[model samples]
Target chain A: MADTQLEADVTVNAVGSSCPGPLMELVGNAKDVDPGTVIRLQSSNEGTEPDVAEWSEESGNELLDVVDRGDHWDLYVRIDD
Target chain B: MTANRPSVLVLGAGAGGTMTANALRRRLDADVTVIDKGRTHRYQPAYYLIPFDYMELADQERDTRELLHDEVSFVEDEVTGIDPDDRRVEGEADSYEYDVLITAVGNDRRPDAVPGMLEGWNRTDSVYPFYHASAAAALGDAVDEFDGGRFLVTVPDTPIKCGGAPLKLTMLMEEHIRKRGLRDDAELVMTKPGAEVFGTGPKAPYQERIEEIWDERDITFVPEFTVSEVDYEEQVVRSAEGDSLEYDLYAPVPPQYGHEFVVENSPLTDGGEYVSVDDNTLQHETYPEVFALGDNADVPTSRTASAARKQSHVVVDNVERYLDGRSPAPDYDGYTACPILTEEGKAMIAEFDYEDSISAPIVSRLNWFLDVNVIPSLYWNVWMRGYDPVP
Candidate 1:
């Protein structure tokens, strides 16, 4: 399934946030969610993709995919077991 | 004898001072206090957007009391001078003693630095400066009423906060005039003291591209011209090298220097009238317990907020290491970034360091979005809040 189409266990709304905001929100909220749960993160910041990509990799979270939504983006991250 | 907590006194609650104070509060058990002349804290980069009427002065300002961490004590008083030997700052009302002193009072516009710069400033509507809010707003009004004649934008002979501001203003005004149907009547002239528009640094390519753009846009570039006097009555700009230009609207960027109080009182200042610190460590060369950052530090680079952000990290780390009783290893490499707004929605991100290499000018709406959207939010929420998560 497309990342944007994936059923998310938790939706992290980072809309209207800037660089590192989406990433910081994800980092802060990821611990509350259970393992194997896919977290949906949305952001409009241009510097978000690379930051989230690197963060997910470094934190052992599985990044499902990043989808461009014109004005913003939807990033899916699956928490690691 | 009563035991007093080791204290850190930060001078000038600007970007560098605020960030340093907040970061140190988290890392140390010391009492962190920040002192400034006023309670107003500004996201100065937003000043550039004002003249174009994209933002208002209120949008760029936040009270320093609210922006600073609650744990960090905030003092709103004018600093008269610092007695380096006594490790105390004499303020207008009271004196503050510190175990460690960090001076972050950035260089501010000195209209009097040049002969005619201050004399003619704001005396007439024909001459305006866009570096400050009031002046920027006035300049905006002037630009709006300008029907025709020469619109001259000038750069200072000294280093400035944003190297891209003068060019950005010229470019934006060109588009504004064109949109208002006055392009043919108004001639846009960019005058700089240097032979080159931008220094022969990593910004060369971007400068070259700008040259091309200006040429195609019918904007004239006058190089190696310094404004020595502005004959506000006669509407003439005179350069020290005996060159002169007549203009209906003159936007001058006067030379900037360190805070008068800090420069005159503290022996930490260099010949440039800024704090003399190690390029990397940001620690004062003569006094190890004293450090400086931001535009006030004589670091042989353009004074920029981006440079201050980078320097903040290094200064915080070294300060922590110093308190831990270790020799400081300087790690700052003069990294700075300037988001050059080309038109309304397009900008180029110019990122480079002390090394004469630059990231090729990346011009796009996305970059503009970062400046108009991302950077400001990050500055207030992440950096100032003392949570610089990004290294």
Candidate 2:
């Protein structure tokens, strides 16, 4: 269950990051990236699943995939066109 | 398990109340009505971070409505008192009847408990108390303008939400001054009503480590000092024990007491404040149908959110058992944890029960990671949302 096959345009390593940190980073970087770009976010926080999903949908982005990486998680989101 | 759906009424949408209400929702198949004073549910531990600019004030609060399960009925009103004999609770707009009542109306912050504390709180830039978010934000500005002189942090004798907060803020201030290159310009001093820097229990090992930090940093530790009044004009703080200290910048931990509803209405209170409950079961000592937890309950332990976490489990279990026609178990052992942030990146986890048995690695970055990263996220998404693993 790896999202590595998608070849993310930008890899955001938020492994050590906390709650709003991971989500805020994604939102900030999502604005800079071109549309149709896939950004991979890594977060160790347990709230990442629902928080990231809600943020992606609310911001009109597509959550492509979520891969649990044991202690952390890899959430892939694509910028909305 | 009973014939009719049990009616559960809870007061205060805080850690203990929210957790107990949600946990009961999972097992009891009951109609739960929650009475909260406001719509905002605050993440209080984050208050400590606001002054240091580690977190924003807005991020510390959430809609209390969203924290509860959909099945639970929410009431937004001010609670006046509880008529325990009638098994009814008096609220501002309406009254509620309950089969089981849980009062989690935690400690109320009384800045005026000590004379002159609130009078000069925001009026002067040199004096600030960071116990609440509004005050914490004000303290942030004060910390910015304060470049030197004695930075005094004092705690009143009354029970506080988090006993470690005063020390944590003191430590954070020391780090902030040093980081801003004002270390030599400022002298750090911490005065508390208690004789020990930490409490007199399993906190010894951690206290020893803290004392070492204070020694190395040249921070003065004043014990057995109860701040009675603050002379804002002269920037002097007088203690009840007839001692005084001068400071250019002061951060005081305000005295905290139970909600007036618990104190004025029911026989559940002792000393005219603080709900009296069975220390282990968390049930009201006099009224069997009523229960209490969080800072509001007089449990004879350090008043911290961590203690409430453990107490929540016992309350939930005992409440369920009580409904099932069984005696409540004395399960709560006063388990309390404080993830004391030593610095921005490093911290320590102080965990102990009633027996005063200390846990391991008194200080580490691991605990800091849990506090800063994992705990808040879990608290928001899981615990408060009725998804806690316990029970």
Candidate 3:
């Protein structure tokens, strides 16, 4: 997925949050949105990729893509219906 | 006019409460008071170092009253309940009223939460929960007598104050064993409930370095081991998944939780283990006049004195603002730090806030010196006195 082309319904800026912080923020924000809503999570913590991946798989959410932004990462996820 | 002055009541006289009270007393013209059940304030970071005889237990202890500012009143009373609605705190000795309340009562170590753990500590000399001051002292003797065998250190599933303490203790023990020429006979092992040795994210660099260090030193790292029971009779620690590891000596970090009064009696927590506060502002969610910091606050960060020191500045600022009829700002960034002692003389610092890792992941003797030599002095003189120059 092209970074500029894709858009998200919600963007969670957990830039400096480590491990569970970014994942927690993503989950918290995802809960308020409707099912199938695409959310973008920005994080600086390296553990977020695998954690979000595992969480998405376990929770039956769609992990659209993970883009590395030099200093941080932007992970896209779609809430399960 | 005197009655119009706002009164601030702080719960617990530990690092958080003392710093909060002292800072508030210095900043505000309000009546600042600290209530705690314990008489002595212990430097808890030294608990791991105490086992190695690196720090004296007596030196780490101070009278709670002595730590507070002269303007701040110290009440030695066990808190029984908190009525946030009426703004009253009930203690075993007396009841007190406050215009503003700040709960900083730290975690309670519960060894009995795990079956046979308490018995092992009491009946056998093999088990030690080094988180407790007395237990840490006792572990010193145990370490001295241990010549060779499987030396095991376990971390609890609960949220502990210093998350890196068990790792530090494990590494220090490995170094001690190697120096004693017991390296061949001694098998050093550390266990955590999670996959990561320390933690992931901002702690990744430090964790990677720790992994390499452990591999080089022949120290065993066991992950996903949730301590279910400590079998004293068999000298083994069993995990929730039915896996068991036999040990000649054991040092386990016991499960920790909030005080019963705060968790059960007070509506401040809203049926949670910690006080339900706005994580950023450090203010109580429902009560504008209430704030929380330290281990008792439900903030998603590692509980440490460093974190409390940072929170003190925010809490004090917000409390003063609230008294002056101003809205509290979301200034706190969930910053916390852990100085991971890799060996006897070398250490690495993992410092981070909500947004990013602040410290470089490098192990050095200077880090050790700062942690061992400098931080404690600063903790007592500057931090406990609420003379923090760095926010």
Best by DockQ: 2
Q: What is candidate 1's lDDT per residue for B1-391, written digit by digit as tens?
A: 0155688899988899988899989988889999886666778887668877787766777778888888999986767798888889998669999888999988767665666554454235576666754466557667889999999988877778888888888888999999999999999998998888866767787778787788889989899898888787888988878999999988877677777777777787855588889998899998888989999898977678888888988888888888778988779888988888888898988877888656776679998898988888899888887777775
True contacts kept of each: 0.00, 0.00, 0.00
Q: For every model shown, what is its TM-score relative to the native structure? A: 0.80, 0.81, 0.82
Reference-based lDDT, each prediction: 0.79, 0.80, 0.86
Residue B116 CA displacement from its true place in model 1, Å: 4.1
Q: Looking at model 2 chain B, which ten-residue stretch has the lowest summed lDDT?
A: B118-127
lDDT by residue (B272-306, candidate 3, tens digit) is 89999998999998998999999999999999999
lDDT per residue (tens digit) for residues B20-131 in model 2: 8888898777888888866667788987788788878677778878888889999877777888888889876788888999999887777767788865562455766667
The TM-score that candidate 1 achieves is: 0.80
Model 1: runs farther than 4 Å from truth? A1-81, B1-4
Model 1 Cα shift for residue B47 (angstroms): 1.8
lDDT of 1: 0.79
> Model 3 chain B — which ten-residue stretch has the worst lDDT?
B117-126
Candidate 2, residues A2-64, lDDT tens digits: the string is 555877889876653434446645654664578999999887666777877876676678888
**Taking the tens digit of each residue's C-alpha lDDT, what string does model 1 give over A46-65?**
67788777767766787888
